[model samples]
Each structure stands twice: as C-alpha cells, then as structure tokens.
Target: MAQRDYAMSGADARRAVETGLAAAEWYHTDIPRKEMKALMARADQPAIRDTGLLFGCMALFAGLGIALWPSWGSAPFWLAYGVLYGSAMDSRWHECGHGTAFRTRWMNDWLYQIASFCMVRNPVQWRWSHARHHTDTIIVGRDPEIQAMRPPALGRIALNFLGLLDAWQGWTKMLRNAAGRLDPDEADYVPEHEAPRLIRVARIWVAIYAATIALALATSSLLPLMVIGLPRLYGAWHHVMTGLLQHAGLADNVTDHRLNTRTVYMNPVSRFIYWNMNYHIEHHMFPMVPFHALPRLHDRIRADLPAPSPSILAAYREVLPILWRQLRNEEHFLTRALPPTARPYRAELHRHAPGVPAE
Candidate 1:
C-alpha cells in the first residue's frame, strides 16, 4: 500500500478531513480504536520501564504511609505524598489506558489499578470516556471531552488561571453532584458497561477510593486532610494545562483524523513535563505511537503535519492572546484547520533507519 501523503499547514489539515470524510467506508469500519492504536510502532522500552518504576516506587511508599502511620507530621506528608503519587499515577493510567505501557492487557489493567489506588477514579470509567475521546476528539457537542468552562466567555480565562484550584474544586463538586447535591453537567460522565461483573468491579473501585478518603479523615490531622485534596487538583490541572498547550483551541472545530490532533512546538523544559506528548498530532494519527517514538515519527512525517505554528513553549505564551480573543467572544477557541493536500505525505523510512522511512 502507498503511504498516505499529507500537506503541511492548517489548510492541508482541512483537506485531509474532506478526503477522509468523503470516503464511503469511514463510518462503517469495524476496526476497534484499541487495535488502531496498537498498530503503531512499539513504545521505547527504556522510557516505559523507567517511568513505571518511578511511579511504582512513589505509590508503594505512599501507600505504606497512608496505612501504617498517618500522623508522622503536623503538615500531613502522607497527604502531600498522595497528591504527588496521584498525579504521577494518573499519567501512568493515561499511558495504560492506551494499552501502551505494557504488552499484556491484564498487566496494563493491574498497573492502571495501582495508579488508581490514590485516585480512586475507576480505570474502566476512564477507559470508556477516553475511547470516545480518541474516536471523536475535538468535535463540538459530539466529543464529550470538549466543552467550555462553566459561565462561559470571560469565565473561561478565570477558570484556566485558577488552574489547579479550579480542578480540585470541580472534583469535590463532582463527588457532591454524584450524590445529587451539585450540578456539573459539563463533566459529562456516563456508565461504561452494564454486566453484573463489571458493576461489581465498579463498586469495588468506588469502595477502595472512598476508603482512602475515609482513612485520611480518621487518621490524619486537619492539615493532612487538606493534602488529600491537593492531588486531585494538581493532576487535573497539570493534565489540562499541558493539553491546552498541546491542542486546545488550536484545531478547527472539525473531527477528521488529522485535524483533530495537533502538534505544539515545545522547549526542552516543556518537553520533559509533557513527556513528549507535545507531538500530539503524531500521537493522534498514530495513537499507539509511544511518547519516546514521537520524535522519530515527526522526523519521518513532519512534511505531512501542519508546519509548526509555534514551538510548544511559544504556543503556551500565545495562548494568552488567544484566551483574550476567546474572552472577547471573537472565537470560542483558537484552533487551526488544514487545507487539502495534492497527495498523501509519505516518508522514506529506509533512508535513515533500516526500516524507518522519512514520512
């Protein structure tokens, strides 16, 4: 099969969409999203192994503290530890949710569960929502993940600035809403499966996470109790803020394969923080493509993707201007869409690495 060619620029992105959407089989294909992801090249072994160990260590020690000695300090180190581990765990969960962390499906689920210990958010729940994200990312009204912050307009800026705090508050509010207390319709979560066994697992997920919270309240001091809240906020905002720089308000409102994903020109600092997720367009086009593999993929396929609008760091800086425009209601978000390409972009893989062609 000939490689698909891509034209660079927001204009080319749009064309890719028209081409894809025009295809008769697109809507009817039975290819599962998971299989599509796995078809990408394998992830880098070193990065995957190292990250797993690091997060694993953090989770282990934190769990020990939470269980054995809940009051070693007045400030609640366990709480702080929980937050840090929670954030890192969520990162692992994100990777595992894609089934890229480990080769075995059951192993990935177990790893995801460990990460979920502090988080308590059921891995299954996230998997279902996330699968939808991969399928209909960035589509307005259709993609459940894409939505304006409440109160809309000016409130969006305020919400982003409040950053982590807003995320923490939202989580708390979600717990409240789940109990029929508050209404955060924007969160938009739906049950994943209805099988009795699945429901039983979901109940266990709820129980374990709730037990962690209960343990904190019973054993830790007031200061420690506050620490538990910090992880939820930090992880939520860290993920969102990074994503905002990644593709938020950057792509056109369309949901085609290429246009839905984006790349952010990034600096070394941001790169480390984002774990190479900055090459989001590459990731989306090839979801199974691991973080470490993105650079290689980019070098191969750069000509096909939209030319770097701004480096990731530059993109973050530019977001303020975009936010201002959004605040003024000029645009809901600052997203770019590509125009059509004359031909699909292909890389000469064997030229550089033995089998890896430049796309």
Candidate 2:
C-alpha cells in the first residue's frame, strides 16, 4: 500500500489533479432553487442572539474567574471561560469568514476580525484558505485542512486537546507572517495582493501578544494570561473533539461530501458552541446556507445523503475503528452506507489511490 503524501507539492497532489479530484464538480443533493434561496437567505437575528449570549456568558465567566482568583473556587469559571475563548471563537471565526453570519456585511467582517484575532488566524490568509477548503475538501495535497491523514497520529490528536500543537503552530505562523513571510503552502492559495493585509494583521497580533505577556510580567500574576493567552490552551478540548469528526477516517479525494464528511447529532449546548456545524453535509453541499439555517437545509437534503451519525459519541465510534485499520491499509476508510431513500454513491468519481482494492 502506498503511504499517503499530504503535501501540496507532493506526488499525491499531482495525482489528485490528474484524476480530476482537484476543483472537480462535487455532488450536492438536489434542492429546488427557490427552497435553496430561502435557506441561503442571510439573517442577523439568530446570529445576533447567539453572539450576544456567547459573549455575555464569557464575560460573566471571566469576571467570576477574576474575582475568585487565587482560590480554587475560580477553577470552574476559568474552565468555562476557556472553552468560549478557545473553542467557540473558532466557529465564530469560521461562520463570519463565510460572510453568512449576519445580514449586514460589516457585521460579518467585524466578527470575523475579532474571532480571527482570538484564534490567531490571519484573517486574509484563512479567508482564502477556507475558500480553497470548500473547493477541494479532503483532496490530499489540495486541501490544506486535512487534519487526520493516513495512519493517524493519535498522539498528536491527544496533545492538541490542550492546544499544545495547533495553537502553538498558529502562533508561530502569526510570528512568521508578522515578519512578512508567507510559507510556500500559504503563498500557493493566498493572493499575492493580500499578503500585505495578512502581514499587517499578524504584526498587530504579535504586538497584542507581546503586550499581554509583558502585562503578566508587570503584574507578577498569571491573571492577565488566564483571560487572554492561557484560555486558548486550557479550553481547546471541545473544538478539537468536534473538529476531528469532520473528515477523519472518511474517503479522501471523493467528489461527494457524504464520502468524506460526517455529520453528528449534538445537544443544544454543543450546537450553540459549534454554531450548528454538526450539519456538516448540508453545510458543505450548500455553503451559502447560514449556520442558523443548516438544520432546515439538512432536513431537506438528508434523504439524498447518507444518514447522519446519531451523536458525537456514535461518530467517534464509527470513525476510530476505520482510522485504526488505515494504519496498515492507507486506502482503508468507511464507505458510509446510504439509506434507501438516498441516492447512491458516485462510485465512478470516487478516486482511490492506485493499486487499492475497491470494497
């Protein structure tokens, strides 16, 4: 079996383009144009309500954490605060990046910038990166965001729960970008014209971080960091947990999202934190649909797609075994069985690595 090369400049990436997996037309469940338009319509109310509540709760938590600091009573408040800072900001950044979070364009841009800062993502760089993600998701060498590669490094996944790897890499990238350097992969996708804006944002972030660290030094207390820098590390678990389910153990280089993405049913709290991204297939199929509208879109399209995993736990159950098997057979992945009401997989376009046996 061939070991998967996930580099943008690797042989597998060349194969992906040659095999028509790069920028190829993907299968989206047929939805009437009128209904899709309704679903895609932008609205500010839902996002406004959610954003207010999210930040409101974060404020309450952060205040309590500060008041009760130097006491173990502050522990829970800090923990709650971290998830909002570390995890929830991720989805906020994501939705706002798509420009569907608010009916007003400026609202979306404002939130995208704030959330991008909290998450250490260069707004200009990630905006283009995410566009590429939608264009060629899970296509090795083309998609920059394939988190779980073949022969999954379970250790790396574990470390990321504490934001040890991803956040640190993000900070390093910010520093490099601050120095006006674009790594090869970033340069490939990010527009040359946007480099200045990306660099400017990175420098601003570096300044903010340096100030935050300097404040900690001046205060002789870790308090400032707990609110700013520390939460990203301490509260990274929830996002890491949910993020891995997006494409881990799914077929790569497939034109169909059902073949690459998994949607799991989650509770209200998780839904709120995730911004309804649990409706993964629907979101991918119709990227224009707002996060608030994903559930309705999912309802309209689920019949044409594989059934969603019943819950987050169930999805991990389904994915973990396949990842374990892929340790030996890199081609190994779960070909999710579609319900009878769903259309069949586009087997013709399901490009597997050469020499891999079809199930």
Name the regions of candidate 1 deviating beyond 4 angstroms: 1-39, 56-86, 116-120, 147-192, 195-202, 220-229, 256-260, 265-273, 309-312, 330-359
Error of 1 at 293 (Å): 1.9
TM-score of each: 0.63, 0.97
- Model 2: residues >4 Å from true position, as ranges? 353-359
Taken over the whole model, the C-alpha lDDT of each candidate is 0.50, 0.88
**lDDT (tens digit, per residue) of candidate 2 on 1-359:** 56778888889889888977899899878878899899999999999999999999999999999999979999999999999999999999999999999999999999999899887778999999899899999888899888898889888989999999989999999999999899999998998999999999999999998999999999998999999988999998988899899989888877889888988999999898899998988888888999999999888877888788899999888888877877777777777788999888866866463324324
Using lDDT as the measure, the top candidate is 2
Worst 10 residues of 1 by lDDT: 349-358
Model 2 clashing residue pairs (backbone): none
Q: Estimate, for each residue in 42-78, the C-alpha lDDT of model 1 and write its tens digit.
A: 5447455656666665566556665665366423545
Number of backbone-clashing residue pairs for each candidate, in the order shown? 33, 0
